[model samples]
Target: MNIETLTWGTLDIKDEQIYHFPKGIPGFEDDIDFALITVEDGPFSYLQSLQNQSVSFLLSDPFVFYPTYEFQLPESDKEELEIADLVNVRCMVTIKEELESSTVNLLAPIVLNPVKRSGKQVVLHNSNYQTRHGLWNVSQDHFEKGGE
Candidate 1:
């Protein structure tokens, strides 16, 4: 499918790349369908809303920045998204601003069930993760390994 994006303009996204968010990303609840676009062979991916061309999110695999980043998805969320296996779910953190001065949201990771084509942002509890962790603080070694 050809999707008009906010940053990259119009591009082709396969059905497999389109994730169905029953309840869209917070704030943009009306736009439930989104496609994960890879801008580069890196950690960054743009979650472009299929319903709204101008709505998109910068997502990053938190594990790359914080090697120790961990979280438990509540049982409720599992049932909500019909996620039967943990391996079927992919996790990503929302990125804000440019890489040098930006921050990554770790407390609430977007959990995507690719097999089911469903996704949701699950806010964690009893964790040290924050909504904004300074990007500069992440270890260079971790980034290097992640990029590889």
Candidate 2:
């Protein structure tokens, strides 16, 4: 399927790349279908909306930046996505001119059931994570040092 995106122009994506979001992401309830375009060499992916050319989100694995970042997937959400085993989690990233200032939304992560080809942006309840967590915190070496 070919989609015209504002950022990437015409993109011919495979069927497997499409994901259905029944409830849609927050603030984007009307846009239900998106293409999960992944970056082969990096920790980033593009969630591009099929319904809107201007709607696209940059997603990244939260764990890549915050090794200790963790969250529980609510049972209700699991059931909704019909997730049995395999699941993919990514957070929306807000990029800035200053790379150090970019933020990732940990409070609400985009959860996907690869087998079912479905996804949801689950807002974590009873969690300490915020919508904008610094994308670049301590250096990567910090994790190697195990925080000293």
Candidate 3:
């Protein structure tokens, strides 16, 4: 299938590669169908919407930056996605940057079932997690002083 994207322009995508988010993301309820397109020679990916050409999100695996990161979804959510094993899941986070710091939402991770091609944005109820978790900046003096 040929997909029209805002970032990558027109591209071909296999039908099986399309991910369906029945409930959509928190703010993008109407745009449920998306394709994960990796930008050429780039670390980020574009979650390009099939329903709306303008709707797209830059995503990346949270573990790439925060190896110790953890995510948990409620039993009901698991049942909804028909998730039986962790191996079938692929997790990603939407990136956000602020002046000197870049942050990813550790509290809400977008979980996808590759086999089923379905996904959901699950908000962790864990108290230790936050909506905006800053990335590690080695250049900061406080980080060198063991402030991380």
Candidate 4:
């Protein structure tokens, strides 16, 4: 399918790349369908809304930055997404003017069930994580390991 995106122009994405967000992302509720465009050989991906060309979010695998980051997905959310065997988690990344100032949202992570092609942004209830964690705070070893 071809989607017109403000950030990447028109993109021909495979059907597997399209995810159905029944509840949508927190701020963009009406835009339910999104394409998960993964950047090759990196921990980054873009969640681009199919309903709105201008709506797009830069997402990063939080584990790449905070290896020890852990959270319990509410049973309700798991039920909503119909997650069973597999789950994919990615947080929104906010890029600032200064590269080092960029932050990734650890408070709310976008959870997806690839097998079912459904997703939702699950906000942690009692998490110590914040919305703005320094994107470059990780040690050089992380990057050297290519975020293993």
lDDT (CA) for every model shown? Answer: 0.75, 0.90, 0.70, 0.90
Task: Give one digit per residue, the lDDT tens place, for model 3 in 23-135.
Answer: 99899999999997766775566688899999987676666666666656788888887787752323444444543366566667778777778888888784465665556
Q: Write the per-residue lDDT of candidate 1 for residues 77-145, one digit (tens) a residue.
A: 988888877433234444445656677787778898877878998888886666766665767565445
Candidate 1: regions farther than 4 A off = 86-98, 139-148
lDDT of 2 by residue, 18-112 (tens): 99999888899999999999999999999999999899999999889888878889899999999999999999999999998888898899999
lDDT of 2 at 54: 98
Models sorted by TM-score, best on top: 4, 2, 1, 3
TM-score of each: 0.83, 0.91, 0.80, 0.92
Model 2 TM-score (2 dp): 0.91
RMSD to native, candidate 2: 3.5
Q: How far off is model 3, as Cα RMSD?
A: 3.9
Q: Which candidate leads in lDDT?
A: 2
lDDT tens per residue, model 4, 34-111: 999999999999999999999999999999988877899999999999999999999999999999889899889999
lDDT of 3 at 103: 59
Candidate 1 C-alpha error for residue 25, in Å: 1.1
Model 2 bad stretches (over 4 Å) = 139-148
